[model samples]
Target chain A: MSLVTDKIISKPKIETRDLGLEMTENNRSLIEISNFDFFYGEKQALFDVSMDIKEREVTAFIGPSGCGKSTLLRCINRMNDLIEVARIGSGKITVNGVDIYDDRVDTIELRKRVGMVFQKSNPFPKSIYENVVYGLRIQGITRKSKLDEAVERCLKGAALWEEVKDRLDTSGLSLSGGQQQRLCIARALAVEPDILLMDEPCSALDPVATAKVEELIHTLKDRYTIVIVTHNMQQAARVSDRTAFFYLGKLIEMNATDQIFMSPDKEQTEAYISGRFG
Target chain B: MKRYFHEELEEIRSHLMLMGEKAVESVKLAMQALLESDIELANQVMESDDVIDDIEKQIDDEVVRYVSLRAPVARDLRLLFVAIKASHDLERVGDEASNIAGRTKKILAQGLPIDAVARVPRMCELAINMLEDSLRSFIQEEESLAYSIVGRDREVDTLNRENFKELVELMKSDSANVSACTEMVFISKSFERIADHAKNIAEEVFYLLTAQSLKEVTRGK
Candidate 1:
C-alpha cells in the first residue's frame, strides 16, 4: 500500500486555571462572590471563596460531609442569620449589581427575592392551597382571585399542579414525599424569587422521585437563577450546567458539569467520582 | 487488583510471538526445501499447520474474555481491540505459510529446475522480516517504527508483481515445467499474503499506541 503523507493538526493544550473564567466584561455574572469568608463563632467555615453564579443557570455545589457546601448555600440567602454564632467576613455577595449585605439593605425584601427549599419537605400542616399562597398572603396580597391565580401559576411552574389541583383543600402533609418536595418548591416560587436555593432537595426521595425533582429543577432554570447543594455525584452530573466541588471548607474546583464528571482538573474531584475514598 | 487481566495480556503477546516465529520458520524451511528439492522438510512444514491454528484459537478466547470482563476504555481498550484484529491477521499469515509449504512440497515432488527460486527466497525473507519488525514495534509501542513498516509495504507488492512476471516467463520457456511453475506462483502469492498480514499488524500497532485510526490517517493524507 502506498503511504499517505497528510500532517495531523493537534489540539492546543489549555491550562487548568484558564478554564471557568468569564472572559468578557459585558457578560457579568448575576451573582458574584468576591473573596467570601464565613465563620461560626471563632471557627472559620469558608476561606477566601470567590466564584460566580451566572444568570438563569443551575449551579450545583458538591462535596464530602462537613465541607461547608450547605453552609455556603445558606450564606447566599443569609440563612446563617438564624444561627446565633454565625458571622460573614472579608468578602461580599452581590446579586444584580447590588450588595445584599449593605447596612441599608432590607433583609425581608432580600428574602422575597431569594427563596429556598430545605433538604426535607417541611410543608405546613395547613391546606395545600394555604401552603402555596402562604408567601403571597404574607406579602399582603389578600384578594381571593389573585391568591387563586398565583396558586395555580406557581403549582404548574413546579410541575405539581395536575396531581394536587383536585386536592387543594387537603393537608400539605397528606401528599407523598416527592409531591411534598415539589409543594415546597411551589411555595418557594410563590414568592416570585429571582434566585432559588435548594439544599439536597432530592436526598430524602427515592430514585424515581428524585428524577422528577431533577426535571423540575431543569424547568425552573428558564426564569430563576438556581443553586443546588447535593451529595449525589450522579444527580449533580445529570442536572447542573456547572458544578462546584468543595472540600474542608475550601472551594477545590468548579467547572462545567460535563468536565467535572468526565475529567476533573483537581485530583480530589477525580478520586471522588471514581469511588476512591471520598 | 485482578491479576488475570495483565496475565492474559502477556499470554496473548507470547502466543503472537510464537506464531510469528513459526511463520518465519515455515517460510525459511520452504525456501531451503525449494533450493535442495527436499520433499521431506517441505512435508514437515505442512504437517505443523495445526499448532498455528490451535494458538490462534487460544489468542481469540483470551482477547474476548478480557474485553467482556474489563470493558476497558482509552489506551487499555485500544490495545485489547487491536489484539483481536492482529490475532486474525496472524492466523491468516499461518494459512499463507501452509500454502507456501504445500507449494514447496509439489515443486519438490515434480523435481523440476526452478529458475525464479532466487527471487522467491528473497521475497520470503523480506516478508518474514517485516512480520518480525511489526511484532517488535507492537511489543515496544513504537509508533514511528510501525509507520515505517507500513510505508515499506509497497516494496513487497513491487517484488511480488516482478516475481509473477518472471515466473510466467519461466513457464512459457519450458512447457514440461508447467506444474512446478504453477506451484512457484502459489508460493509467490503466499509471500505476498504474508507481507499483507505484516502490513496489517503495523497498522494495528499504530492504532493501539495512538488511538487514531490508521486507515483514516492514511486516507486524509
Candidate 2:
C-alpha cells in the first residue's frame, strides 16, 4: 500500500454544483414561449413563463394542483381564451415561429392545426365513425369515400381501429372510458393537427385504459409535437420525451423525462415529484 | 399516506442496514477465522450466509410491492430502487465473506503458517471499513463520504494486485510454500471482490441520494 506514484489522483466527492435549471436544449423548438405572462382579470396566473417545445416530441407538464401547469398548456392553443377575463399581460408565444395572437391569425384555422383532448373524453353523442370524422366534417368534408378513409386511418393511428372498426355506426359514448379517450384522440388526429394538447386525458381512466392512451400518445408523437398536462407523474414519465415542471405559475424545470423523474435540478421539482410537498 | 410511504422507505433502509451489519460481521469473523486458524468460527461465518440471502429476498419483495402499489417518483422512486440494488450487493459481499471463510478452513487444514498471509487481514480490514462506512453514509446521508469510498476502491484494487504479484513470487521461489501461497492469492482475490462490493454499495448510495448513477457522475470527473 506504501507504493507511491507521481500520477495525480483526485478523491471522488459528491459535490453540490449549481445545477442550472432552465429549458433543456433541444434540436429545434416547434413552439417557443418567451416571457409569456398570463392573467385572469386582475390576478396574474403565470410569471414570465419561457420554454421551447421541440418538434415531433412529447413534452409533459407536471405539477401539483393550482401550479398552473394546465394554464401554461392552455396557452399553446389559446384554450385560455375561453375564460372571459383571460389575457396575456406580457411576452409572446409563437407556434412555428408565427405569433399565434397576431390579428391576421385565424383562431379556428389555428385550432385545426392544433387539436386538443380534454380531461373528460367528451366524444359527441354521435356514431363512432362520426366522432372520428367530426373535425373533417366541420371543415365541410362531405364526401363519403373521403370520410370513410379518414375514419380507418385515424382510428388505426389512435390504436382503436381493431376495437371500434366493426361498430362504425355505434354511438361514441358506447365505447369504454379508455376507448372513449382513444376515440377522442382519433377525432383529434383526423384534423391532421401538427400539435396535440392533451389536458389530463387519462385522469378519469382505468389502468388498462390509461395504458392504451399512453401507448397511443407514444405512437402519436412521430407526427405531432404533443404537449400533455398530467397529474400522474408515472404517466408523464412513461409517455413523454421531455417534461416541464411548473409551480405556482413559475416554470420550475424542464428536462428529459428520465432526468426530471430521477434527479431534477431544482429542489422544488424534486419535492413535487417525490411527493415530499407540492 | 405520504408518511406511510416514507416509513416503508425507512423500513427498507433499516433492512439494508441490518443486512450491511451482518455482511460486515461476516468479513470481520472471516478475517478472525483466517488469522487465528479457528475452524469453528470459519464454519459459523459460512453458515450464517442464509441470513443475508433472506434479507435480500425480503427487500426484493418489498420493492416490487412498493413500486406496484405506491408508484413512487423522484427520490421516493430512487430509494426503493437503491434498496433492492444495495441489498443485492450486500448479499454478494456475504458470499465473498463465506468464500473467504471456506478458504480459511482450507488454509487451516494444511497447517499453513498464517504469518505468510498477514497482509490479507490488513486488506480485509480496509475492505470491511469501506463496507461499514458505505452503509453509514447511506443511513446517515453523509453522501460525500459514500462517493469518497467509491474513489478509494482503486486503492483496494492496487493492494490486491501487488499482494498477488508478491504471492506468486513466493510460490515460484519455494516449491514447499506453493500450496499456501496459492491459497493466499485466492484469499486476496476474495478481498478484492469484497472491496468491489463495497464500491458498489457506495454507488448505490449515490443513486439513492441524487437519483444519478455514481459512475455517470464520476465518468466526466
Candidate 3:
C-alpha cells in the first residue's frame, strides 16, 4: 500500500465500547458447541472449545493459521465428516437444539439448513441462473417457473441481481472473481438456509471486490445467522457483530466486535491483533 | 515478535514527548518573562510556539500514516488515539503560553507594576506541574499519577478565580493602571486554560491505560 499523503487533522472520537449488538432475549441461540473436542486420527485438532452462536448475527472466527478456527467452523456444519481421519473425540454440537451428530439426523438436511461458501469461489460449470437453482434442482424441483423465481430472489438477496440479471444465460465461471463469489453466495441463498458460513470469501479478490462481498455480508447478516472464518482481522472487525479469537485450538476471547477490536479482554488476543504476538 | 511498524510507533511516542517538553518550556519561559519584565524572553516564548505547532503537525501525519498502513488495534490503537488527542492538547497549551507571553509584553511596554501579577506565578506553577505530571504519567504508564493530576486542577482553577476577582478590584481602584490590570486578568485565565489542557491530557492517558473515560470512572466515585 502506498503512503497516504493527505493530512487529515481531526479529533479522534472515543466511541462507547458497546455497539448495541449484544445478544438479548430476542436473539436466541441458533447453534451450540459444548465442550467440543475433535481429532484427525490420533492428532487432536480442537481442544475443549465451546460457544453459542446467536441467530441473525455475524460471528467471526479469527486467529493465526492452524489455530482450529476453520476446524471449529467446519464442525458447525459437520463438513469435517468428509475427511475419513477426522472424528469427534468428545462432546456434542447442536444446531437449533438438535444434536447434528446423532444417527437419526440426516447430514443432507443438516447441510440444507446451514449453507457454506468456501475460501475460493467455486461456481459450478453452469449458467448463472442454473447455479442459483442448483440447490433446488437437487431437491427435485425442476419446474421452470419455480426455479426462475428462486433464481431472481436468491440473486437479489445476494446483491448480484442488477449486475447479473441480464447475464443469466452466461456461464457462472465467466464472471469476475468478485462476481463469482457473489454468485456462489446467491447459490447458497437458493436453499434459504438459516445460517451462512463464509470461509474467507473475499481473500482472492481486489479491494473493490472485497468491499462488495463485505457489503453483501453486512446486508445478509440481519436475515441469516452468519459465521465467517477469515485470516484478515480488519475484515472480521468490519463485518462481524461478535468476534471470537482463537489460539492453539483454544478460544481466547469472544466479545462484541467493537470491544474486541478496540480493547480485547485477553492479553494474547491483544498481542495477536496488534501484531505483537510471536 | 516485534513488527517492523513498531519503530514508527516509537517515533510518534518520542515526538509527543519532545512536544510536551517544548510546551512546558514555553509556559515556564512565559512566566519568567512576566516576572522579570523581560520583553526578549516573552518574544522568544511567542516565537518558539511555531516549533510546537510543527511538531503537532508531524505527530498527526505519522499517526495517520501508521493507522492507514499498519492497521493498529487494541493497545496500539489506543495509543494512536491518545497520541492524536494529547498532541492537540499540547498544541493548545503552546497557544496558551504564547498568549500569556503576548500579554506579558503588553504589561512590560506599559511599565505596569508587577505587584498586580502576584497570583499568576503560583497559577503558572500549578499549570506546569500538571502538564509535566501528565507527560510523566504517559511515559511511565502510571495510572494513579494521571488520576491524581485530574483532581489537582481544582486548585489551579480556584487560584485563577481569585486572581480574576482581585484584578477586577485593582482595575476599579487604580483607574490609571486599568489597562495593565486588564492584561493581568487574561494572563491569569491563560494559565488556568493551560491547566485545563493538562487535565485533558491526563484524562487521555487514563483512557490509553484503562480504555475507560476518566470522567466516567470518577463519576461513580
- Give each prediction's DockQ, rounded to 2 decimals: 0.02, 0.05, 0.06
lDDT of each: 0.80, 0.83, 0.87
The docking category that best describes candidate 1 is incorrect
> Which ranges in model 2 have alpha carbons more than 4 Å from their true place?
A1-27, B1-221
Better structure of 1 and 2 per TM-score: 2
Considering lDDT, which of the candidate structures 1 and 3 is the better prediction for this target? 3
Against the true structure, candidate 3 reaches a TM-score of 0.58
Q: By the TM-score metric, which is better: model 1 or model 3?
A: 3
Q: What DockQ results for candidate 1?
A: 0.02
lDDT of 2 by residue, A206-256 (tens): 987887788788778777789999999878876788999988888999999
Q: How well does model 3 score by local distance difference test? A: 0.87
Residue-by-residue lDDT tens digits, candidate 2, B36-61: 77999999999999999999999987
Stretches > 4 Å off in candidate 3: A1-26, B1-184, B187-221
Residue pairs with colliding backbones in model 2 are none
Candidate 1 residue runs with Cα over 4 Å from true position: A1-28, B1-221
On residues A1-278, what C-alpha lDDT tens digit does candidate 3 reach at each position? 11111111122221111111232344787788899999999988889988989889999999999999999999887788777788998989887677777755555666777899998999999999999999999999999999999999999988899998988999999999999999999999998788899998989999888888888898897789999999998888767888999998889899888778777899999999889999
